[model samples]
Target: MKSHIYITRHGESQWNVECKVQGITDTPLTSKGIEQAHELAKKIKESGIKIDEILHSPLSRAADTAKIIAEENGLPLTLEPRLVEQNFGEYEGHEWKKYPGVFHEAKKQFACDYNGGESMLRLGQRIYNLLDELKVRSEKENKTFLLVTHGGIARMIHSYFNSETNEEFSSTNTGNCEIKEYVF
Candidate 1:
């Protein structure tokens, strides 16, 4: 690809403000989050990234952020099912403090599904596949992409682009609307 692919976590959501676990929970963005998206669009313009397409998670937080960016950049948005956050099942809506070591332990156990949620291995499969597909698409079309997704999904994308320790993968929490560039 002539240009790099980019990624960003959706702006702050209601759950994010409350510090709750929001795996696949359709949490909406707050007023400040809307402002953040607007600011992100400005930053993108200044960066001169020239993204060809904007892809976003189906979740409202990500979708809405993508809408703002796309409108500013004059690019079409695509709903990427593969970008969905890892389903945390019973952990949803609860504060992360309530879980204590649950998340850390669960992440280490790639096969564990959080009693009803998706396993890390499964999350890796979908995210890695999407990255591969994005690389091929970028090369075939000579285009760049911007992926709007959640923090959990961003961790997987980071792993796809770099070698990471288990600690790094489990501990990562991307800043809201901060853009990260990657090459294919």
Candidate 2:
């Protein structure tokens, strides 16, 4: 049987507005980010989607967003370490534009470890492992899940299930607070 999964990227962080790299760096959400989380909760409620639980990244931005959504929807929230963002290593907190080649290289080589950071392939594996666990749990419990994660992880998850090529996966991106649903 297929399970319904709701996935969302965390709301905008301070680093996001500053256009800085935030991989594995803890940053709080802006006021607009809080609003976005509330909006997402409202949207889910209005749409009558039933969420059994919320699994969120441990980062502050994602945790805060998950808190709001879980509270609003009366779902239990659990922090899933595997859902954390890709570690950008030395690039964390730096301007993204300054290391254009790093991004390009990462995209080209899914196994490339960025400046001593985590590789795209490793990130994908963790996310897939979480998904596999969730799939089994959802099947046993007959429940749906809401996953709150970072943009990089979100894109990786999307690519893991949807993309047929590295180029296709690299081209995919998720906007802050954007929601994507899948039946798996």
Candidate 2, position 39, lDDT: 96
Off by over 4 Å in 2: 99-102
**C-alpha positional error of residue 166 in candidate 1 after TM-score superposition, expressed in Å:** 1.1
* lDDT by residue (tens digit), candidate 2, 149-179: 9988888878757856767777778888888
Candidate 1: stretches off by over 4 Å: 1-3
Query: Across residues 73-119, which tens digit of lDDT does each residue of candidate 1 receive?
Result: 79899999999899987778877687687766667777888889998
Scanning candidate 1 in windows of ten residues, the lowest lDDT window is 99-108
Give the whole-model CA lDDT for all candidates, comma-separated.
0.89, 0.86
RMSD per model, one decimal: 1.3, 1.5
